[model samples]
Target: MRVLHLAPYPPARDGIGAYARVLAAALADRGHETAVVAARPHPSSPPEVLGALGDPGLPEKIARFRPDLVHVQFAVPAFGLRVPAVLRLLRELDAPVVATLHEITRDTALLRAPGRLLYRRLASRCAALIVHTRDARAAAGSAELIPHFCAPPPPSTTTSDALRARFSLGSAPVVLAFGFIHVDKGLDVLADALRHVDDAMLVVAGAVRARDPLFKPMELRDRRHEREVRAALTRHGLAHRVVFTGHVPEAEVAAWFATAAVAVLPYRKAAQSGVAHLALASRTPLVATAVGGLPDLFSASGSATEPREAGEPSRGLLAPPGDAAELAKAIRTVLDGGGHPLQGLAPGPEEVAARTEALYERVLAGAV
Candidate 1:
């Protein structure tokens, strides 16, 4: 089968783009021909990236590619949180589309009634809407649940001692918090939690989403929150406890996960997290908030816990979103547990790709 990935592919600096790159590579390895139509023009993108969104002649280019299916790595953040642009892509695409809704519960999380209507409109045009968790499938009303893809963890190149020395980290457990630097990610909550943990060091493995000359409202909000976090940390004399390694490369990202005693996702609001999947790939022990589809990951069913989120008490791996005290406790618990990595990584990348291919077959046959 031939497939075309429609997303912010690499050189574009989005996780879903990185996702598309990996999925396309896996599909190609599975003997399928694959290509990409990036979300924007990135001059340095690889050859398989044939065109970009908003190119007047992109439709012609996709027509020439003649893909059997088009997979859209749909996320509001990737579109700079613009609904109209997302709608335009859904309405205008001229091939069978299977959209991976990277975020679904955001509308519900914020109680934004209009966003729900927009989601419905987007779903109506697709052959199938794919979500990574059953919580998302439930919230989406109509969607297919696919396991998130995780490539095997790479071997750690540098020892923990070397990593600590390189980063000027003192003798303390490292708690990692990564992905886009944004307020909703609860960096403020994380900073406050650090006050309680007392001994661990935080390695913030990212920078703000992107640079904007005019400074859009969203950009301003993120920057303001980051400043507040920094100020609070300084006031508490915890400035030396945190290190911000802004926007690192893939190798460095691996290194951080390798050295981290625990990975914390203290999102105040979220749809799901790609970072969680990365931690799973790294087999890093995690402490995450109960929000969006995160609960589905802990549930053996990967299904709904519904009206209330599920918690992994057996593993002590979950905390209430935005609760600094609970987050601090969870981090301490992981550290006390000797940093034994979390177990289980079923349905790795190849399995996920095969499942995706099966979904494509269903869509092409009008069975989805």
Candidate 2:
């Protein structure tokens, strides 16, 4: 099978880009011919670049590739949140299209009304639609549910001791919050939560980037939020307890997960999280707020109760969103070995890729 993926390519500094690279590699490993039409030019052979999303030559490029399946990794901001333009592009594509909708925002009446209209139009055009969470599936009306997949962590070369020594982190327990620094991620809440957790170092990974690439032109370089976070830390006497490792290499991400006592996802709102998947795959105990698809991802038994059967532990702990005291308590519990170590919860990348392949076949066969 020949699969053509449309999204940002690897080293593009976007989550969809990283995901496309992983999914393409996994599909290739499974004996499929995979190629990408990236948002920007990359060094990948056979010239993968297709210019930007709104480029006029995209249809010609797709016709040239002539793939059996065209898989689109969809996020609103990636297409500049231009609903009409995106809908037009989807209509123009004459392939067996399968779109994975990354986010369906419903936070406000203003965004929700048009967002729904746009999604319905896109869904009508595509052969099939995919979403990561049950909530998203329900909201999308006719979309299929697929869990967000993650590659397994690489083997740790350096120990926690070495990591601590390298970063000059002493004996304090480490709490990590990774990925791009955005207001929706609730970094402010995280800073407040750290105030209640005693003797723990908070590591805020990744650098700030434009929240909306199209509208927010200078938002990438804006550090006002960072300064506010720093002020909060100083006011709470946590300035010395937090470390900001801005924009570390991708290879070193696993090491950060390995060194942490607990990985925290303090998102105020989300559809699903690839970071949460990574922490679970790494077998690191997680502490996330009960939001979006997080509860579904963490709970083995799919209930608020503990994991069914004796000796089988739960994946991680969940607290109420934006509740600093509760988050503090959960963090302490995980660091104290009271939280369950995630085990055998998520499917491997190859298995996920196989499922995706099956979806493609079904779409092509008119079974969807």
Candidate 3:
């Protein structure tokens, strides 16, 4: 089926952007004609730039392509341009629409009250909705929960051993906290937790942008969180061990993943994480907090290497949110677990893409 993906995509560089980019690639691989319409959030651009252009000739583009469905990978606050306007246009075109909820918050996590109100107006109008995990599904209210698809980074063509060596890491045990650095990401908590692991070096990758929701707040606590992350690292003498490689390019990230012993998600608030999916696709062991849709990602059957069973604990270890000591303990478990990497927890990209295709077909059949 011809499918149009109306969601934020890179080089805009955000979680949902990355998700939409990769998902579009997978849909194309599944023999569906997929095209993406993304927003360009310039530093100086007005906040309502996307909304100003209503359909912005998007209907013509959709009609020209003749898509069977228009799938929106929603990110609530970030992908504002795509969701509400696209959903509104689909109504005019009388075409089926699918809204993928990348975030599901019962209470406000990031977006301000006004932003939340705007999001709700758009969310309630979709033909159907998709979320990444069961937790997200439960939060979706009337939307469908679809498993996210993850494809392996095209076979490692580069060697991160050189990169690792360059940092004097020289085979030091590495724990990666990948993706955008935001207040919700709990980087300070991670920095505090790592103070206990003397031999381990933390590789904090991903870029920081002003549009990042974390900095949107003017509260002293939020500002102080950013300051504390930098200050705490220095105060604790962790400046050398904690490396923030601000937003490494996509092409270069796979090598870092390959070099790491484990990847951590120290999110204070989350809906679902594409980083966790990427780590799983890379077949790396994971350590994450037990919030949002994270616990649904893995299962622990006492078999550390395999994915968790339906009712089992997660494949990865989980700790309390914002507790540095608990986060540190979870990290220790992953490191001491005799190298049992988390694998086979979820379907591969092909399987996930197939499932998505079936969902698209159902939506076209008026299942939504």
TM-score leader: 1
Badly placed stretches (over 4 Å) of model 1 are: 81-93, 107-111, 152-162, 211-215, 299-316, 338-343
Residue 165 lDDT (model 1): 93
**lDDT over C-alpha atoms for residue 111 of model 2:** 58
lDDT of 1 by residue, 283-308 (tens): 67788888876665565443332312
Give a tens-digit lDDT track for model 3, residues 220-303: 454566677889899988898877777677677788888888899998888777888788777677888878877766554435
Q: RMSD in Å for candidate 3, one decimal?
A: 5.0
Candidate achieving higher lDDT, 1 or 2: 1
The C-alpha stretches of model 3 lying farther than 4 A from their native spots are 41-57, 80-91, 106-108, 112-119, 212-215, 218-224, 300-315, 338-343
- The worst-scoring run of ten residues by lDDT in candidate 3 lies at 44-53
Compared with the true structure, the alpha-carbon lDDT of candidate 3 equals 0.70
Clashes of each: 0, 0, 9
Compared with the true structure, the alpha-carbon lDDT of candidate 1 equals 0.78
Better model by TM-score, 1 or 3?
A: 1
* TM of each candidate vs. truth: 0.88, 0.87, 0.84
Clash count for candidate 2 is 0
Task: Return the candidate ranking by TM-score, descending.
Answer: 1, 2, 3
lDDT of 2 by residue, 26-86 (tens): 9999999877766555455244555445667867776777788878888766555444555
- The number of the candidate with the highest lDDT is 1
